[model samples]
Target: MKLKLYADRMSQPVRAVIIFCKKNGIDFEEIRVDIAKRQNLTPEYAEINPMKQLPAIVDGRFKLFESHAILVYLASSFPGVADHWYPADVFKRSKIHSVLDWHHSNLRRGPTTIVRNTVLAPVLGRPLNPEAAAEGEKFLSASLSKIESVWLKGNGRFLLGGNQPSIADLSLVCDIMQLELLGETERNRLLGPYKEVQQWIENTRNATNPHFDEVHKILMKAKEKLQNPRMKGATNEGGGSDMKRTLHSRI
Candidate 1:
């Protein structure tokens, strides 16, 4: 049987996994798990991923959840994957591991909270939380600073001074892609000051391009809908069906 990746592109980790597979020519069926409809919470999904999360995988009978672990598994298990992604060198690999682990608490925290409050909440039929957004900005700025000064300070374009992008680069960059849902001013306000982070993001995007933009098309569409006043009105009416229509089968 072919590999199966249970994913929803709206999810950052899912997008990352999809991009990695596409980039590496890994043949896997992308099983879309629409989170907006709570498809991930279904009993069948729970059996696949006991944690009930998007971006899980079923490689034959082997089932796995958590995006980071999934990425590592794919990089090592799949042939033709480039060494730059995970690297066979023990110390370099350990550094990549450090970044991925830090990503969970630091890098992941900011974008998830901020995007949900500013744009995603309304789409999910939930109310916006400005207070949370405000708090998230602090974490966001600090995390960006860490990435700029520590991660990107190296000689290479990606993390740890490597010319090629690593799994850490893919994961963190995909995490920040959610910020595309925000308006330009808010996005620039958060990312503009950090020149290194901006350039690094661009490098990662360029390196992964076509596929990078392809996977993020859902976010870009959602961003446009969030901007168009008519779309906004439609999204608010009729039990928010327009909003669902915009996101479903795409994000």
Candidate 2:
């Protein structure tokens, strides 16, 4: 059996995983799980991911969930995946892990919460919460400042002085991309202050193009769809090439 990826590009982490697989030329099939439709909450998906998350995977009999875990698994398991993503060097891998862990509480929390409260609330059947958005902005601003002062200051195109983009780079950038749904003026206001962070976003995108752009088309589509009050719901489809082959991978 070929590896099966359960995902939806509307998700930030899901987009990261998809871009990683594409950049590494990993062969697999993507099974899209529509959150708006609540497909991920169904019993069938529960067996694959008890947490009922947007991105999960089945590699032969082994099942995995959580975007960062999946990225590390793929980077280490797949023959096609390059070592730079999750390097074998014990120290380097640990450093990368630190960034990934730091992301959830800092960078990921901000943008995800803000996006949900602002534009994404209506689609998710949620109410706008300016209180939560205000809090989220605090985290977002702090996260950006940390990135500028600590990570980007190293004079590398990617995070942690990596010449090439790593799994951490992809993961964090995808989270920031959620800002694309905001109006240009608002988006610029938030991101414009951090010149290095802005440039890092571009660098990561350049490192993994066409696929990065392809996977993120949903953001633009959603932005457009949200403008039309008449639309009830939008379609949630998988992104990436079919590119299937027989499954054989490590843990």
Candidate 3:
């Protein structure tokens, strides 16, 4: 069965699947959803993903949501392609899974919230409260510190017990890419103090992931567009406007 990915091209979760597929040489067709237009709330997308989230997939009769779930499904489905990506060893596999869980609760939400509140909202001509931005930065800083501590305790080439890329790396890399794409200054600020984290990010960027360069280019372009007043209205496609709306709606 041909795999169908429902996602926004510029979304980090979507990019994660793209990078995962590229690295494993798995071919999948992409169905782009413009989140800025609130396309995710439409009944059509709602049927595929009740959560109305991007990076969901349909594989024949099976459908899945959440990037980490998609990664595990893809890895297990295409056996012998990259064993190290999702090792068979029980302990190692558990470790990778643990990090993936931590990612969703801790690292992932913090910086993403910060980026949306501080950068994307202003670009969309929405009000950006400094107090909320400060809160986001605080959360992001705490998450980064946790990541630094974990890296310091481990072997450091990849997350868990591998010298090569693993599911842990893929999960972390996608979120870090989102943080970096917020802007150069914010990127440097978040990554500068964590040398190991910085190195790990660099390694993933240089790895054999086919969509790595493409993802980076898209993010960079998004950042540039967010910074330009003239391109403000035009930059709301993909996850930009939705993210902004979510951020403000929360406040």
Best by TM-score: 1
Point out where model 3 deviates above 4 Å. Answer: 230-251
Q: What clash pairs does model 1 have?
A: 10-251
lDDT per residue, candidate 3, 1-251, as tens digits? Answer: 77999977667778878888877888888887778678888999999999998889999998899899999999999745578888788987888888888887777777667777777666567787677767767777777787767743577576653578887787777777777546677678777888877877777777754468875576776667555546545655535554455433322
**Candidate 1 per-residue C-alpha lDDT over 1-251 given as tens digits, one digit per residue, 9 for 90 to 100:** 89999998989999999999999999999998888678888999999998988889999999998989999999999999999999999999999999999988888889889988877676666799999998888889899999988988778999989999999999999998888888788888888898888888899999998999999987886787776646566554433466666565344
**Candidate with the larger TM-score of 1 and 3:** 1
In candidate 3, position 60 carries an lDDT of 92
The segments of candidate 1 whose C-alpha lies over 4 angstroms from its true place after superposition are 231-240, 248-251
Model 1 lDDT on a 0 to 1 scale: 0.87
Structural similarity to truth (TM-score) of each candidate: 0.93, 0.88, 0.86
Q: State the TM-score for model 3.
A: 0.86
Output the TM-score of candidate 1: 0.93
lDDT of each: 0.87, 0.81, 0.74
lDDT of 2 by residue, 191-237 (tens): 99999999999999999998999998877765545454344233232
Better of 1 and 3 by lDDT: 1
Cα RMSDs, all models = 2.6, 7.3, 4.3
